[model samples]
Target: MADPFGMTELTEILRTSIGLDADVRFDGELAETEFAELGYDSLAMIELASQVQRRYGVRITDEAVLDQMRSPREAVDFVNSLLAGKVA
Candidate 1:
């Protein structure tokens, strides 16, 4: 399967989901910035995860996995891995 969400796309989703400033950088920040630093509470994460499932068709049903996704880059990587597994 093709990569449904590129880093840019994933970053955009995260930015929108977390209500970040449009000018905020994401490339390096995405990997380093924790979700809490971006003002994402547990409710926000649940919403984000739901949006991810809806938009990417990747089910993130595990709370542990969601807890592990501390940054946008991690979320993007996890989603890509799930997509790759489907293709394989």
Candidate 2:
């Protein structure tokens, strides 16, 4: 079976999804605190989620989920759960 998650893909997704500069390092292990530390706000979360939804074809209707995401890993897990048919 394919790897449940692709690190390179995830990194690329995050880099584009968050509008990060190409030179920025996106290691795919950012924590929620790191997001806050980096100044990610409510609007940024919405935009990021929207970008992820469009790119990954995963719908994130619950805004709370985005609000609850404290890290890139959590966001990936949430999207993976939705893709696995765990949320509908």
Candidate 3:
């Protein structure tokens, strides 16, 4: 079976980048943001973003975007859109 989220390649990139073990389907809601609650901190976010850029071959140069990516789900959606040639 194909991974549902993996349909968007960047979602797979996010999983690899963030070491996410669980499936994440992001709808981009701020109320659902929970990365820190899930044990991701600044260091983890930075590492994840770096890996995302490297894997996706896109430069995520906006620091504000890092602050806004507050959960594994959110990060997956954001990166997925970016890779799809869309804005998150």
The prediction achieving the highest lDDT against the true structure is 1
Candidate 2: C-alpha RMSD to true structure equals 3.4
Cand. 1 Cα-lDDT: 0.73
Task: Report the lDDT tens digits of candidate 3 across residue range 21-47.
Answer: 576554456326676886667777777
lDDT of 2 by residue, 1-88 (tens): 5535444555676576655656655454443334566677767777767766776677776565556555666666666777688434
TM-score of each: 0.78, 0.63, 0.57
Candidate 1 lDDT over residue span 13-72, tens digit each = 767775667776767755668878877788777777787788878788658345766687
Clashing pairs in 1: none
The TM-score, computed over Cα atoms with residue i paired to residue i, of candidate 2 is 0.63
**lDDT of every model, 2 decimals:** 0.73, 0.61, 0.60
Each candidate: RMSD: 2.4, 3.4, 5.6
CA deviation > 4 Å runs, candidate 1: 1-3, 15-18, 62-65
